[model samples]
Target: MAAKDTKNIKLAKQIYDALSTEFPDSSCSLETDCPQNLAIRGILSAQCTDKRVNITARQLFDRFPDMESIASQEPEVIAEIIKPCGLTASKTKSVMAFAKKMTDEWGGVIPNDVDALMEVPGIGKKIANLIVGEVYGTPAVVVDTHCKRVMKRTGITDSEDPAKVEKDIMKAFPEAQWISIGHLSVDLGRKYCTARAPKCGECPLSSFCKRRI
Candidate 1:
């Protein structure tokens, strides 16, 4: 391996260890009882808080119950129910599209393949990776805003782009750590390495964080 890769690997281990110790019970914040429900929640989570998404999704599912029911509803109705999560028009189309796919194509089974999941309109790489990783236990990294901020600030990757950061993380950490690293990065970002006025001193990774030094 190259010298840069060696350094990143070592640093990544330290970060993983520290974050593991700091947030021992980190998990995906999206609340759902079923895989399809989780997939729908992922679609609704764009530019919205997970807590709001959860609430709106509950309202949505309480009425629809199944993709077949959702697929059958008018886009306007779905839009009305999901308006609280914002982006009503586009999110409505995407949610109905996903439901139709679930009922018409996938036969109620959410796919484990990321690319396949991304075929639905609003389901981008982030949501696709989340669906596969969370739903199927696949080793895919979810580089959300929190993950992006924390990874860059930690000197794990010199890039701010989520895609590049994801690749850097993939190369630095083992496959088993991929899913949890995203959660851990999120914990670090939310608790200490925030986008503005970060709490570096109190951060668990302060000892090794380049930004802290």
Candidate 2:
């Protein structure tokens, strides 16, 4: 590799180690045990907070009970159940479609491949990576909004698009650190690197962060 690229990778590792220490045991905020449940929760999380998604997920599961029950429900019913998470109509379609696909096509098996997850409606690269990393224990860079903002401010990437940010992170850090980086960045993003008027002075990464304005 070029000398400049090599230096960046070394720097990235330093940042990773620091953040990992600061936010040990970091993980996806969405609470779900099963892949199918996680897939549904991810769909509900778009433009929504993890807290709200988790609350709505409990209500949804209570009403529907299982994947087969969810697949059999009318779109209207699903929408009504998840209305608190917002974008009810679209989220409902995505959840139902995903459930049906899992039931009819994969025999209730969640695909470990990103492309396969993306085939489900509302399952974008972010959710796909989350599922693969969490459910399948695979290396994945889940560039959600918090991840995108924190990585850019930390001088990890110049791109704002999630796909590009994911690429930059993958290149800068080792595969084993990919999943942990996402969670650590998110924890930092929420506590110190907030979108507006970030608490940079108190941030652990402030010393090295570009602090892009």
lDDT of 2 at 57: 98
Which regions in candidate 2 have their CA more than 4 angstroms from the true location? none
Write candidate 2's Cα lDDT for 47-160 as tens digits: 999999999998999888789999998788888889999998889989998999988999889988999889988889999888889898899998988999988887778889
What are the lDDT scores of the predictions, listed in order?
0.92, 0.88
List TM-score per model, in order: 0.98, 0.96
For residue 140, model 1's alpha carbon misses the true position, in angstroms, by 0.2
lDDT of 1 by residue, 1-213 (tens): 999999999999999998999999999989848999999999999999889999999999999999999999888899999999999988999999999999999988998999888899999999999999998899999999999988888899999888899999999999999999998887888888888999988988888888888
Clashing pairs in 1: none
Measured by lDDT, the strongest candidate is 1
